[model samples]
Target: MQFLYGVQLLIMILMPLIQMVMKAIGIGFVSYLGSNLIIDQAMNYIVSQMSGAGAVVQQILGLAKIDVAINIYFSAITTRMVLSGLNKLQDRKRAQVWRAPGGTSIEA
Candidate 1:
């Protein structure tokens, strides 16, 4: 029990650091993608090819003569990546708890 507590304490201490590193990586990735002209053009082409709400959004921005910054798209992608990472981390914790010795399995 003491060993388990120690491990838990260590994880608690490291979690924030892990999240901070992830955020930093996400920001760096977005910046890199935004700064590359080829990637930027590719992304614009992809967005323009998109249908439904994407089309409407593109039309709106075009009509308004607003050149949406690349950061807008990249920031959204970064946010999604971070959220997905957090969800996976939580899922792993839940799996550990559910699969621990003598722990009851949850059925869907």
Candidate 2:
């Protein structure tokens, strides 16, 4: 848990550090990344999955956008990772929560 906190903190701290570098480069790096082909592909994939959800949603609510869902998905996945990592990190709680501890360690 503490380790995951460290990682999340590291990510949050580094984002601005990196963004500062991009800003120094004279092109708003946010806009640069936003215009990337990979983003387009990811957004298309998410919207396609929403359409597959099959509920006539877009007709009734014309605002079912992929950007919102993608942000939600990112938060959900990141939270799941950090919490699950923390859950496994607690020595006393590990056996209760996970089938194995020292999961990547053979010395156990």
lDDT of each: 0.71, 0.67
Q: Per-residue error at 46 for model 2, in Å? A: 5.8
Candidate 2: residue pairs that collide = none
lDDT of 1 at 65: 50
Q: Which regions of candidate 2 deviate over 4 angstroms?
A: 1-62, 92-108
Best by lDDT: 1
Model 1, residue 60: what's the lDDT?
A: 83
Residue 41 of candidate 1: its Cα lDDT? 79
Task: Mark the 10 consecutive residues where model 2 has the least summed lDDT.
Answer: 92-101
Q: How far is candidate 2 from the true structure (C-alpha RMSD, Å)?
A: 15.4
Give me the overall lDDT of model 2: 0.67
Off by over 4 Å in 1: 38-108
Residue 87 displacement (Å), model 2? 0.7
C-alpha-based local distance difference test score of model 1 = 0.71
Question: Where's the lowest-lDDT run of ten residues in candidate 1?
Answer: 94-103
